[model samples]
Target: MRGVTELLRPVWRTLPWPSLGAGSAAGLLLAGMARLYPENFDPWLALNTLRTAALAFALGLAFLLDDPARHTTATVPVPRFVRQSLRLALVAPIAALWWTATVLLIPAELRPPVGATTLEAGAACALALAGSAAWIRRSQEPEPGVSVAAGLLTVAVLAALLLPDDWELLVAVGDPGWDAAHGRWGVLLGAAVGGWLISTREPART
Candidate 1:
């Protein structure tokens, strides 16, 4: 436990705070826009706005694994997963608070169901992290954030444009497909988390 505690400060310094802060701010702004014209807000608008906000934040999270000192740290006594986990542990509370504030930005009477929207956000954030983890696993890039962020954005755009209705993951509330869509989201979240864990494994010494 003391070892873990000792890692906290250095790990905190290594976080991609700029991107994370930008993403959090962008998400909050987008969600808060719904409040600008409270009378114009409706369930559908609320849902899509929140979704966009979530995506914005997830884009920032895509940079979570970025480290200019990645190669240098690879030689450290501590394991990569422990370092990574420390980074996450530090950010988790901030993320929770950001999400809470974002949700509260929408008027309660017109807000979409929190549980479902939160699932979508969670899935998106997991996908971003998984992408970064996979990149680290497959390549030697010291900072993969740019490519990962671009890829994340591309995936989101393609998913929005290409995913067919039957397989849709972003259905509106009250739609016949809402429940099924969330089920798929649950699967996606699970897969992303699994992929992250698997990718965190250091390559076997050649």
Candidate 2:
């Protein structure tokens, strides 16, 4: 347990930039694309991008927390689950900070509906954190062939969820317009999963 904690410390320090970069890039691209197609784009779509970026950031933090590098000294005294919980606890505030910054960076007109956006951002953060915890606790690194299979399965599931029927289903739940507002949920989800996988698994010792 001490070892795991020690291993994760360095990851926590260094992994923030890459995750922030990915989230920012994803957010900016979505915003840019919306601007390009003003006639077709709904301004509210920016909110989705912001929410997605927040989730990506949260997931990235989770990966950093789980990195084997941060666990070195961790074995001395701490129980593994306790350490893991401590790391997970950090995700909420960091995600909140990221969301605050993101909201500040957006143009007033392009920002999400005020109070609702905050709630959505918080929800995304929670989802990302929960998902990462689940993955870390239950999943293992797959063999090459299995990895490919898993990737394919993820794609299939995403497609099924984002396709026309899926859109209709979401609409049935509430707001059919939301399905058409932003189509980047799949990309955000993929980023969260990929970032978690890449960050948490052991890398060659540096």
Q: Using Cα atoms with residue i matched to residue i, what is each candidate's TM-score against the true structure? A: 0.97, 0.50
Against the reference, the lDDT scores of all candidates come to 0.90, 0.48
lDDT of 2 by residue, 1-206 (tens): 56665646653564445654565556555555545655554444665555555544444443433344433533456554555455555455665565666666565666655555554444444445445544554444221222332443364357547777544312211365654423444445456555544544433447
lDDT of 1 by residue, 16-133 (tens): 9999999999999998888888888888989999999999999999999999999888887778788787777788899999999999999998789999999999999999988998
The alpha-carbon deviation from the true structure for residue 19 of candidate 1, after best TM-score superposition, in angstroms, is 0.4
Q: Candidate 1, overall lDDT? A: 0.90
Model 2 RMSD vs true structure: 8.6
The 10-residue segment of model 2 with minimum total lDDT is 141-150
The TM-score of predicted model 2 comes to 0.50
Per-model C-alpha RMSD: 1.0, 8.6
* RMSD (Cα, Å) of model 1: 1.0
